[model samples]
Target: MFKNSPYTIYGITALILIILLIILFSYLGLNLYIISYLISINLVTFLYYGFDKLIAGFESVRIPELVLHSLALAGGSPAGLLAQKLFRHKTIKTSFQMTYWAIVILQIILILWLSF
Candidate 1:
């Protein structure tokens, strides 16, 4: 039952696509590869949130919050926020919100520090 879930399919699809992109990007310059990786990760992250929301009421296993946060930390926080608003998922839970915001803030700081 769990293995046949749409989320599993999504995960597999995303993984395959990401791997293919990585292989393609390897032939490209580092800057281009970095950009492609970021875009892919964000797209995957957005889909993950939507999928998690879709499965919220079902008995099927939901995407773990840790995975969500890890994705955001991997540079998908903007997509995470967009997905939260678009899917109306993970916006109300105070604990989750706090942690998410913290991650965002840290990312912002890291970016600013790097830009200096």
Candidate 2:
């Protein structure tokens, strides 16, 4: 049981340590807002690209076409919008373009909501 479970055991231990650290920091009254924001930024980029690939299918080089509005709903819209526009890979397709812009608008609204 222990042989094949080594990697899983190590991973679980690391995850527990991280959770403990988070709990300790919060207990100590440390604010994690900034750290959370930075982590979100990084995750957004990765998620956007991943979503794109998922939506496009395996054969398409343009990446999968994930639901952009949904991603934006989850705080990854802005990154997805920027990446799609800059890369110009999925910009021309009617479905992708439309959904991408729709997500952009949604993100703007979310930003406003968060700010106020």
Candidate 3:
């Protein structure tokens, strides 16, 4: 099914895994803190997509640009990038697109920085 589009396959599988993880956590009555963290991450991911779309409309404003970076910094970079690519919503010839990817790269560096 995914022979033509590996990205779609990976995205769908990742989404199913997230849902299953949530269900398992809920079923097991896992720690509230962990659940909260998961929820926050999802919220950020959702907002990142929305903000990316907004950038598509306005094509201005550095604040939204920074929020994009911060969302990535907050650990939603991979999902945000996937959404942008899959939706083809923000891929264009503009600083917004350039900055968004730059932020993604920065987020990865920050994550690695904190991890190591």
Please name the candidate that would achieve the greatest lDDT relative to the true structure.
Answer: 1
Give the per-residue lDDT digits (tens) of candidate 2, residues 1-116: 64535344433443454455556556666668555443454355545555555656555334224433444454555666666666554666797678767766876887799999
User: Which parts of model 3 have CA positions greater than 4 angstroms off?
Assistant: 1-28, 32-39, 47-63
Q: Considering TM-score, which of the candidate structures 1 and 3 is the better prediction for this target? A: 1
Tens digit of per-residue lDDT, candidate 1, span 42-83 = 888898899899989999778878778877888889999999
Q: Cα lDDT for residue 114, model 2?
A: 92
Identify the superior model by lDDT, candidate 2 or candidate 3: 3
TM-score of candidate 1 on Cα atoms, chains taken together: 0.79
TM-score of each: 0.79, 0.45, 0.48
Between prediction 2 and prediction 3, which has the larger TM-score?
Answer: 3
Itemize residue pairs with steric clashes in candidate 2.
Answer: 52-63, 52-64, 53-63, 53-64, 54-64, 55-64, 55-65, 56-64, 56-65
- Clash count, candidate 2: 9
Off by over 4 Å in 2: 1-31, 34-38, 41-44, 47-64, 113-116
Question: Can you write out model 3's per-residue Cα lDDT over 1-116, one digit (the tens) per residue?
Answer: 74645345434444565566566667677757566446655555665466556665674432244445555565566666776676675567488677777876786787699999
